[model samples]
Structure formats: C-alpha cells, structure tokens
Target: MEIVIPEGSGPIAVHGFARPRPERAEELERLLLSFVAPTRAEPGAWQYQVHRDAADPTTLVFYELWRSRDDLRAHLAQPDLARFQRDRMHYLREDLEIHWLTPLTAEAP
Candidate 1:
C-alpha cells in the first residue's frame, strides 16, 4: 500500500515500554524483534527502534514513527500483530502502554 502524507503535517510517533515475566524475558525479546523487519518494510514506516534496558534487562522499550495515524492503524491490523497480542500474555507481566507523541522541537545536543 502507498502512503501519502499531507503537507505540513508531522509524523505520528509511538513510544512504549514493555516488561516481561523475568523468566520469559528472552522469549519475549525474540518475539518483539520479530516485528522489526516486517514493520520497517511497510510503506509508512519512517523509523522503528526497539530498545532494551541496560540495568533492567527484562524491560524493553519501543520507539516508532509512522507517516500518520492511519498508517499506524494499518500496522496494528497486520496479522503478526494479532498473533503477537494473543501470545503476549504468556510472557508479559503487565500491559504495554503506548502513547502518541506530537513533536514540537528536535535538536542536537
């Protein structure tokens, strides 16, 4: 599918954190990384990054940007996401909370 971004509009940013059951961390990490390739291949993906915490090994965080909310919706509707949601409960200790971010300013430090 082709994604068209309207002029003067910003990309939609999705940021979230996930913590898995301690013993299931590796299993969950493997599951989470499985989405990267397919998600990055999508037409709407501007960036996709999964971050694993240093001090907290079981906690994983995700930062993703898509062309628009519609693009994000498309991502959510993918088959892998459906399966992931179903399997996540076996590994995750808590629900992941993802928030939409509106970028105001970005600068290099």
Candidate 2:
C-alpha cells in the first residue's frame, strides 16, 4: 500500500506493512486506531483515516489531509509521532512508503 498526500492539499499517503505474524496484524490495527484522535485534533489536519487492504491483511494505509505542505512536514517532525513510528517499525518488513501529492482537483468524495 502507498499513501499519496496531494501537494496543495497536504500529504498524499502513508503505507505500512505488517509482519506475517497474525498477532502483528492486530497490533498494527490497534496502534493505528490510537493515532486517530490525536491526528484529527491537529491544526492542519483536514482528513485522516486508517485503512487495511481487503485483499491483503498484512498491508495498511493511512490517508491524511493537511492544510499545507508545511503542515504535513511539521506533523512528520512532531515528537509524539516518533513513538508511533518506532513501535510500528518492528512490524514492517521494509521502510514505510510515503508519497506527497499535488492534486488536479479535490480528492475523491
């Protein structure tokens, strides 16, 4: 999975891959849910969602919306976010794939 944050709207994507272990799947789900509230409360956040692929249980994706590119960059640098990254890293087979995007129009409704 890949997250695509549009350039003008904000970060386009965040993709997470979980360990093959069944338990790791559940752990990633819990961790993602835990971030929802905090991420939604952010000043520049417009949309934030945690997504799991229906076809592939081991893949996770985060769709985020921010006020601007700077806001997205700031979010990435936040200290609180560090812990989540650290914890999730152990479960990922490879580094997360994040994409910053510039949309042609508004994102899909």
Candidate 3:
C-alpha cells in the first residue's frame, strides 16, 4: 500500500522503514498488515499504508498522514498501535527509521 501526503502545513507526514529478523519475517509481516484497517478507520488519519520490499522480503516500510501532530499522537496512543509497538521489535532486526515531515510543496494530477 501507499499514501501520498497533500502539500500543506496542517497535516503531518510520517514515513518509516523496518527490517525484521529473518526468522520472524512471516510473523512480523502479519502483525504489520493488521494495522491497515484500524489505522485507516482513524478520524484523523488522512492515509496509511504498509509496504514490503521486493528485493528484501524482510524489509518493511510505511507511510502515514495525519490531520495534525495531535492526531498522530492519538494514533500512537491507540490500543492497536500499542500492541504493535510491543510486538514489532520482538520480530525486528534493526530499529525503525521514522521521520516526521512537513510538506512544503507537492504536485498532484
């Protein structure tokens, strides 16, 4: 899945990458995939998507957009996200690389 954040100051863009332990790849994938539905249901969530690297199957990446920083915080505080946080690292190799972005410009058709 993929999400393209709109160009604006009000919305927050979140992007990240994760590498799962080879032995736990399947479990980790399942865990991450589970976030799709609940996350999209969030009122403040503009977009959310999880991706798997074609070359490195253990690699995972995701992009999300929220109405504001507070909305992003609310997402992190949600029970579903909490569970994912607790379990994800157990199956992951390296720490997630997450960035909070402020979109200054964009071009969309």
Candidate 4:
C-alpha cells in the first residue's frame, strides 16, 4: 500500500544514507531502528522507514515524508534526533548524506 500524503499539505520527502564504522554496524542499526516508532508517531510524519543496503550491510538508508517543511524542521529539533546528530560520529564512518526530494509523480492511485 502507498502512503496518502494529504492534498495541499506541501509534503516534504527526505532521503538519507548513513554508513557505520565496520565494527559499529550492529550498534548503528539498533540506534537507527530506535527512531522508527517514535518518528512515525510524530504529528506530521507520513512515513518513516529504515533499510540496510543489500550489497553493503554496513550502509543504512532512511526515507521520510513529512507534511511540510515546518514538520521536517520540528522533527530535526526533537531531542533524540538532536542527540543522535551530536553523537553520530561514534557510530558513523562519515557524515550523514541527506537529500531533499520532490515528487515527480501524481499522488498514489
């Protein structure tokens, strides 16, 4: 099933990649998983998912959809997220790579 992004909500989509230090892969996965539930519970979150790259287990990717830019900003300001950003270096091999996306297709049928 597809997520229904509310009409006129100006939804914002984010795509990100995080590669953990080889020795910290499992720990990084656990930390990333911890955000799933709480992030999906946030007010404007349409979707929040995490995945491990099939060919490269140490690489993690995130897909998020928020109702608006404001909502996305709010999520970034959340305490847990702030803490994660502060301590990411301990778990990641490099800085997180983030991309803001624009929908090219019409709403899901």
Model 4 agreement with the true structure over 1-109: per-residue lDDT tens digits = 1223333447778888999999999988998999999999888888899998899867999998777877777897899888887888899888888877765542422
What CA RMSD would you report for each candidate?
6.1, 4.4, 5.7, 6.5
lDDT (Cα, tens digit) per residue for candidate 1, span 9-77: 556777878899988898888888999999999878877889987887678999988776677778977
Worst 10-residue lDDT window for candidate 2 reads: 1-10
TM-score of each: 0.81, 0.70, 0.80, 0.84
Q: If ranked by TM-score, best first, what sequence of candidates would result?
A: 4, 1, 3, 2
The lDDT, on a scale of 0 to 1, for candidate 3 is: 0.76
Candidate 1: residue pairs that collide: none
Cα lDDT of candidate 2 equals: 0.63
Q: Give a tens-digit lDDT track for model 2, residues 1-109.
A: 3223444543344334444346576776787778899888777777788888788758777777666777666776677666656555566666676655554453533
TM-score attained by model 4: 0.84
Clashes (candidate 1) = 0
Q: Pick the candidate with the highest TM-score.
A: 4
After TM-score superposition, the amount by which residue 83's alpha carbon in candidate 1 deviates from its true location, in angstroms, is 1.6
TM-score of 2: 0.70
Judge candidate 3 at residue 101 and give its lDDT. 86
